[model samples]
Target: MNKRISTILLSALFSVSAFAAPTSYSVDPTHTFAVASWSHFGFSTPTAVFAGAEGTITYDAEKPAQSDIAISVSIETVDTFVDKLTEEFLGEDWFNAAMYPKATFVSTKVVPKGDNKFAVTGDLTIKGTTKTVTMDATLNGMGEHPMSKKQAIGFDAETVIKRSDFGIDQYVPYVGDEITLRLTTEAQAK
Candidate 1:
């Protein structure tokens, strides 16, 4: 019957749309940065900015849960504003940038939290140690970029990680074992 054929055709069309492939975007290193902050000896909080992030983000606007991200931050790019402290961080006492060189995060799961927010669980690796961590992320904006004239997406995420877990616990209770990481990124379709 005509009605039966129409129903089947409609179902097939919906199925195709539902299973559409996600879009891939290359991270814009110039617009992506990560800030790591920790309490320094209970007197003040010191923050360092890690620039020049590189990675890919596979995003599905229709089904955000299917989205995933992978990013790498170079240790050599860390800047703490103080020349002495920055040099110290690159040494063996802290991050040991010579050995690590980079820190990375690869998402394993993306859970939508409504209102353009998501709980992203991923494996974070630092100094060759990997640990599962979750970041509270928000989709900042998505559309054609003005400067690049390309489809672009932006996000902001925050997570707390313990340096001790990654074998970088120098002062522990004194310098604060837990470090807060905030990431802001913009990616463009490649």
Candidate 2:
């Protein structure tokens, strides 16, 4: 190739690589999970664990506004500590798992709030109802995997939702309507 043509081609390739961001990453189910807790009877406390979920996370540190994430949680895998309690909670009175078998969250916007923080606005679907929820998220950081030497990014986020908003209005006077959720996602370069 001619010298000038070679230089221009090389420049274009370098720029494309610099701007090309990983578009998606498969969630490591073993490493990612959702933990949520709330008051039980205003005295006793309870927690449910969500397992058997799969999703993809799309992110670019330079283009936070274009970042996106989506996850699917299996309602049938909801664990509530006690069989009876878990069954009831997953039934029509709470999550209605019998009919609405899955919960999902999809990001609509990701805006930088400050200092490695972001305001993530998304739609959360529970019991077949979709509600817009905003959460505070942080890009915990990124680094190379010690074993794979691949790029990885860590993230953490928290959000609160009202169960009643999704028709889960049981034990009103006792159980707190406000439910808080915490999530952590570690994404590797693809």
Candidate 3:
């Protein structure tokens, strides 16, 4: 009877440890970039690069589902190359930087697709509007960062979002409703 009880307790403990928490990481701004591209009149495509983002990542390799991901972008850093357009993006008709200064994404779920690939679904908030968005993510690499002297991970993610959904449809059908985002990040374990 005593042996059986001990075995049962051990099994329960092992089960709970199956989803071990992952390592925590801090976003390395110098090595990360978030950029968006939208079409113009269905002919020319222009890109807007977000200069920097700050975030934390808790990654789990054994239990990928247990990972936590969050990213916050400063709207003021949006660079569209054109001085006029850059200013316009923050106007009341668009992102409205004055009202909502930061754009944030917090992961709700992570689905593994094998081969270091994952589908990250989360809530993306911009200009006081929140919407569910999914990004195709790839774990590019995991190693050490020479400068930071810590374990580091690299990721590449891509997602398509509708500007109209976020209430940024200033130009609407004319300015292109769909926007494609390509983001790359290198984070050092904290």
The top-ranked prediction according to lDDT is 1
Order of candidate numbers by lDDT, starting with the best: 1, 3, 2
- Per-residue alpha-carbon lDDT of model 3 for 20-89, expressed as tens digits? 6689999988877788998898899999987568999899888888787898888888899999999999
Candidate 3 regions exceeding 4 Å error are 1-21
For this target, which candidate reaches the highest TM-score against the unseen true structure? 1
Residue 149 accuracy (lDDT) in model 3? 77
Assess every candidate by TM-score: 0.89, 0.83, 0.87
Clashing residue pairs in candidate 3, if any?
none
lDDT-better candidate, 1 vs 2 = 1
lDDT of 1 by residue, 1-190 (tens): 9999999999999989788788899999999999999999889998999987999999998989989999999999999999998998898877889999999999999999999999999999988899999999999999899998998999999999999998888778898999999999999999
Error of 3 at 12 (Å): 22
Error of 3 at 177 (Å): 0.2
Q: Give the distance in Å from residue 179's predicted Cα in candidate 1 to where it truly belongs.
A: 0.6
Q: Rate the local accuracy (lDDT) of all candidates.
A: 0.94, 0.83, 0.89
Q: Which stretches of candidate 2 lie over 4 Å from their true place?
A: 1-18, 147-149
